[model samples]
Target: MGSRTILSSGTKTEQVFGYSRAVRAGDFIFVSGTTAMGPDGPVGEADIVAQSAECLRRIEEALAHFGAGLNTVVRTRVFVTDIDQWRRVGEAHSARFAEILPTTTIVGISALFDPRLLVEIEADAVLTTG
Candidate 1:
């Protein structure tokens, strides 16, 4: 078994909410739901595709801490405030994982922590040791 490690994004809410942005246990890495949050608030408030890209960027950053990348991702769960915006979010998601083509699930929700956040994405990856 490999050692466990917690990755942080240095956000105050992590301590407040008592959670790490991602955790690597053994050969698996699990990333928390990431959004388009910025220093002040959410970014790309009205653009679903932009928000989705930001979420993936945050997830990628988290994964990189453990020597993993989106190509290593095996699964992803995407949450959105509106299902109608799936097309935009899907496009953004594909742009990042077109070659990787990981398994995914997208669901609609009533709201998120911040009203401005339209998309949230989480991912799971396995270390590709060679």
Candidate 2:
């Protein structure tokens, strides 16, 4: 087994929930379901597009902790509060992954931990080069 590295965003939720923001097991890194969680509250509140982008942004930040980037991603799972707004979320996803084209899935969910959160994204990445 490769060295295990745990990454933390140092958020209170992580401490309370007893989870790491991302975990690297060997060359594979798993980023937890991330949302637009801002210092004030859920960022972009009711805007799915903004929330979606923020979700990816947070995931990207987590990935960077392990010297990984979106291009290293192998798969992504998106959860949206409303399925009808999938196109808006897709735009954000495509903007980051147009070239890499990681396998992805988008699903509609009832609600998130916070009512203001509209989207959550989880990612799996493999370090290919270094």
Candidate 3:
């Protein structure tokens, strides 16, 4: 067993929901489902690719906080409101993890917490160096 740490994104939803954005236990890091919510509101507006990119970016930020990166990711889960828009969302996701190609799952849901959010992503990573 190694050190454990909690990482927060400082979003109201996190506090309201009583969950951290990510948790690091030993050499593994688990990131919560992330969306593209911005200062004004959900990002991407109506573009699934952009929204997906934002979600990945948020996940990367959380990983970086704990000295990890996308390369360390072992798995990812993506949830989308529309299955038909998978191509665009997959393109955005591929741009980030193309080289690493971590195990990934994409699913379609009826809705998200916010209607404006079309996609949410969660990731799990293991530190390889240690």
> Which tens-of-lDDT digit does each residue in 1-130 have in candidate 1?
5899999887888989999999999999999999999987777767889889889988998988899889999999999999999988999999999999999999999999988889999999998655
Question: Which residue runs does candidate 3 get wrong by more than 4 Å?
Answer: none
Q: Rank the candidates by lDDT, best first.
A: 3, 2, 1
lDDT of 3 by residue, 1-130 (tens): 5898999878888999999999999999999999998887778888889999999998999999999999999999999999999888999999999999999999999999879899999999999763
- Per-candidate TM-scores read 0.94, 0.94, 0.95
C-alpha root-mean-square deviation, each candidate: 1.5, 1.5, 1.3
Runs of candidate 1 with Cα error greater than 4 angstroms are none
Instruction: Give lDDT per model, in order.
Output: 0.92, 0.92, 0.93
Lowest lDDT sum, 10 consecutive residues, model 3, at: 39-48
Error of 2 at 87 (Å): 0.8
Give me the displacement of residue 19 in model 2, in angstroms.
Answer: 0.7
Error of 3 at 103 (Å): 0.5
